[model samples]
Target: MPVPEPALSVRGVSHAFGRVQALDNVSLSVAPGSFTALLGVNGAGKTTLFSLITRLYDNVSGEIRVFGHDVRRRPGPALAALGVVFQSRALDRDLTVRQNLAYHAALHGLTRAQTWARTEGLVDRVGLTEQIDTPVSALSGGQARRAEIARALLHAPHLLLLDEATVGLDVRSRREVLGTVRELVAEENVGVLWATHLFDEIAPEDDAVVLHRGRVLATGTARDIARGGDLASAFLDMTGLEPAEGRL
Candidate 1:
């Protein structure tokens, strides 16, 4: 049998902004139902990579594909197979959770009934049942984040890209959000690319791709990349940094 195509494929992708090279020949792949962490420090090109994958910028040097559809040549279907939650908060503050999800569902061309059904389903799935009727501004940070996650899943995309999804939440909230996403991967078979700089966010079981200064430095299971040592130690060795607190 032929090998199956990856859920997401980035090949030789490079990007530049004037004199600054934001990304340099970056490449990675994500498999279906798997959780892959894109680990990098601030200004290490994590957001740049996400921007390229989402086509927020113009043409780049390499190719990107979602579920076998080239992002440039067949953008519509390719995009339809992908979902994203950026580091920024994107919820409409004035809208209720249901309202926000419904708006996004409509954007994907869901009919009234389909929209309502999916809204309810995702709200329950993301554990926002109690806050479904609350406006985004009234919800807590974690609640709003959950709502956004629900909105991203509203389209039922095959792959989900979360850029620093747990940036500001407390430890409990972070754990909840991370656990919820992992559950989705196992139960819904949704592929995930979770981008974060925090080493604690990556579990040992997760597949990891370490991005350092716009290039991929390592790729393997988290433990393998850590080389049987703690992730922090491995990180320092790979990046050639001296021991220090509060660094990547």
Candidate 2:
């Protein structure tokens, strides 16, 4: 059988900041409906890669394509096909959950009727139905994070890019958000590029790319990289870092 085209593609992409080369010929692809994790340490150029893909920054070299459309040549369509959930909260703390979603919907060119329908579905999906009318500042941290996810989905994007999305959440909230992401991929057929450092965030069967020093060190199923041990240890080994000398 012929291979299916990737939903998102990055080829020979590289970027720089002054004397520091952030990305050095980095390349990867996200298959349709697949949940691919981008694993890296702090300042490993993960955020730089995200910025390039989202067109937040223009790279001087290489190609970025979304669903076969080149991001550099056709930015509008490429961006329209993507939904981004940044690490930081982007919602207005003073706005009601519903209102914040409405603003996002408007930006995505959704009509009033479509916005309301999408908002209701997302609010329910993210388990925020009860707090839909409450101001964002009144919600807990987890609730705010869920709201951000809901807002990102306002356009029904084909690809979702999450950057450290579960960083500060408690265990319960983290699982809740991750569960929502899994359901989205399974049900909506949306591809995901989840950038995170936590091993728990990657399911055993998921495909992942280990990035270190602005390069892809390994890419395969989590089990393949783990090689019978846990992913955290495998990751440490690949990055040339030794595990701490203490038992868990």
Local accuracy by lDDT, each model: 0.89, 0.90
Off by over 4 Å in 1: 242-248
* Residue-wise C-alpha lDDT for candidate 2, range 1-248, written one tens digit per residue: 98877889999999999889899999899999999999887678889999999899997799999998898999989989999998788899999999999999888889999998899999999999999999999998889989999998889998999998988899999999999998999999999999987787888799899888788989999999999998988888778765542111
- Return the TM-score for each candidate structure: 0.96, 0.95
- What residue pairs clash in candidate 1, if any at all? none
Tell me the tens digit of each residue's lDDT in model 1 across 1-248.
Answer: 98878999999998889999888999899999999999887777989888878778754588999999988888888878888999999999999999999888888888998888888888998899989999999998888888989999998998999999998999999998999899999999999999998899899989999898888999999999988899988887887766653264
Clashing pairs in 2: none
Cα-based RMSD of candidate 2:
2.0
Worst 10 residues of 1 by lDDT: 239-248
Instruction: Give the runs in model 2 whose Cα sits over 4 Å from its true position.
Output: 244-248
